[model samples]
Target: MLAWAGCLGYAAYYSGLDAVAGISAGAVAGNGVHGAVGWLFSTGDELGRAGVYALTLAALSAGSVLLRRHGVRELPGAVVVLGACWLFLDSHIFWPRGVFTMLAFAVGFGLLTVAASRWSGRLTNP
Candidate 1:
């Protein structure tokens, strides 16, 4: 399917960006930004990865817009909250803590899905 191929292509493009950024910053060959949040923050040159995070936010916001358009009102707000968590609050969601990190994403996604569905139903019904 063209949609699947498009998704894969975009995935490859972003992966390439991460690889280029990570490798050029002396990260290991495969790990994007050294493969963990701890490493991303702990790196000596904070400014070096500034572009990476900026680009990340930019790309993510595009999806956030799609979320908003699809009736998932929480995403734009979540993006704001999570972006703040990543930036000002320094939340541990970005840390590498075994399965806890994965759990965080899973939970966040679960909440998002629930909220989105509820809002989606409301938007459609009303």
Candidate 2:
């Protein structure tokens, strides 16, 4: 959950619109570079933007580490909140390869959930 939140947060902050565009392009034209470049070049104020991005990444990494140690169920609300923020923050932006990123995240999360569920069941059932 924390990892997902971090990824989502990073996606939102870096290239939401470009992500969407990238996804669309990949779906229609089979390419993401155009959309990705769009966002990459859009970063006009590098120093300030980098600072903000760095802070956000730090927070996300810290949150993920803390949450992992504590357990996902112990802070379900926080997980949901972070996930929502990530989704909303990225929804407005488009990027090249954005669709692929979303798909990757979804698949990764799905696999993680399934694996965790199986592990939990094994621990309880055994």
On TM-score, the leading prediction is: 1
Tens digits of per-residue lDDT for model 2 on 3-86?
Answer: 556556555644543444444444544454565554443442232244335434544565466457546642443443345334
lDDT of each: 0.48, 0.46
Model 2 TM-score is 0.31
Candidate 2 residue 109 C-alpha distance from true site, Å: 0.5
Please, what are the lDDT tens digits per residue for candidate 1 over residues 1-126? 433443454455445545544554455534554456445435523432353354345436544654756655556545543443244223233454524534644555565656667765753655
lDDT score of residue 61 within candidate 2: 62
For residue 43, give model 2's deviation from the true position in Å. 4.4
In angstroms, the error of model 1 at 96 is: 6.4
